[model samples]
Target: MTAVIYKSKYGSTKRYAEWLAEALGADLLVRESVRAERLRQYDTLIYGGGIYAGGIAGISLLKNCFPAAEGQRLAVFAVGAAPETPESRKALLSKNFTPAMAEAPLFMLRGAMDFGKMTLKDRMMMNLMKKMLDKKPEEEREEWEKNLMSLWGRASDWCDPANLQPILNWAEN
Candidate 1:
């Protein structure tokens, strides 16, 4: 038995979760609805969440309840605006997961960005980031900053089912 759980802020993560759950014939559960006792029943647990400020939304579910699922297979997928490169993935895992939890396989998926739907704080942060990027020469900006600049004032959807393949393979095996 496998459970696919997610915490999505603006839908990208939820979309991926839906695709994954359907593909795996697993239980689809929201992060908020998960309980430690319930988690013990699953032979495998796959958690997905959107990246926000160097954190995975609703990741507390795993950090707080994983003991009950000890010895069970665990995997995590993170959806974010950043490109999925080895460096980015390693950085995200290091910043977000605890030492023990970091041992699990992690999959990174590109996500959508909709400024209009973002919270005021997120908007403000973006504004600040924009100002900083503006100060940097084009050649000096990193790939992520360049991508962010391109996404300004527009919504971009990079959520595709193909990105879930690696996770599916891991879960199935």
Candidate 2:
């Protein structure tokens, strides 16, 4: 097994990476810590990131550090507070991945959102997005965004291990 590189701002994605690393007996690293010199020895590169609005972070930069990783055994996963159903999963990939990214193995894992743990910028960004979308009727916004804006409480265990088998299989390959 090679390394699982995670670019997590909020800890959810990193949690999955750690779990996967433990499962595979591999090194778990943050993307920033993986320079080209550091990553060249690894045969597999897995990138995990969280989603906000509609974009995935850090994975886009992987090509720069590990261009060869593009054709290798690459896996990606995202953790989010949104429900993980076939429909929600579809929306997540559509929102985050470009057409070129569709080929990489993709996984959607449920994640927690704690309003209190959020940084000031993230808090403000969520609030601002909510307010901007508030002008529209409730029915206009997508279901996921509606759930994303609801910040009344904290949830810690959205990354269900039962749903982690796909990741296990991918890493094993």
Candidate 3:
């Protein structure tokens, strides 16, 4: 049995989790509802979380419960606003996972970003980011910075069910 668990702040991660669960005929669960001890019940565990502050939100649950899933197949997907690139994926993998999780395949999926949906704190942080980016010359800004600047204060949806195909393939295998 496979289970797809996710932590979504603004619905994009949950959207992907729902698609994956439906496609794989796996159980769909929110991260908060899962118990660590029950993680051993699933033969395959798929976790998805929105990326915040360069870390996967609610990932501590997986890290803590991983020991119980020692022999299980594990995979993780991170949803973020940035476009998928090899360098971005590598950076996320390095920042988010420990050496012990090396066996788990990590998938990167682009998510939506809506300033209107953001919380007060989130909005403030984005504004601060915008200020920082404004200070940097356009030529000096990196690719990620440039991309984020383009979407600043704008609403964009990059979530596509097609993005879940790689995960579906992995789950089937």
Best by lDDT: 3
Per-residue lDDT value at 41 in model 3: 92
Candidate 3 whole-model C-alpha lDDT, 0 to 1: 0.90
Which candidate model has the greater TM-score, 1 or 2? 1
TM-scores, one per candidate = 0.94, 0.79, 0.95
TM-score, cand. 2 vs. native: 0.79
Cα lDDT of model 3 by residue, 47-160, tens digit: 999988888998888777675755798899999998778887888788877777778999999999999999999999889999999999999998879999988878999999
Best by TM-score: 3
- By lDDT rank, best first, the candidates go 3, 1, 2
Query: Residue 119 of candidate 2: its Cα lDDT?
Result: 91
Candidate ordering by TM-score (highest first): 3, 1, 2
Tens digit of per-residue lDDT, candidate 1, span 131-166: 999999999988888988988989888999999999
Model 3 segments more than 4 A misplaced: none
Which digits, one per residue and each the tens of the lDDT, describe model 2 over residues 12-107? 888888888888888888877777677667788778888776566676656455456445566788777777667766776776566656667778
Give, for candidate 3, the lowest lDDT window spanning 10 residues.
62-71
What TM value does model 3 have? Answer: 0.95
Relative to the true structure, how large is the alpha-carbon lDDT of every model? 0.88, 0.74, 0.90
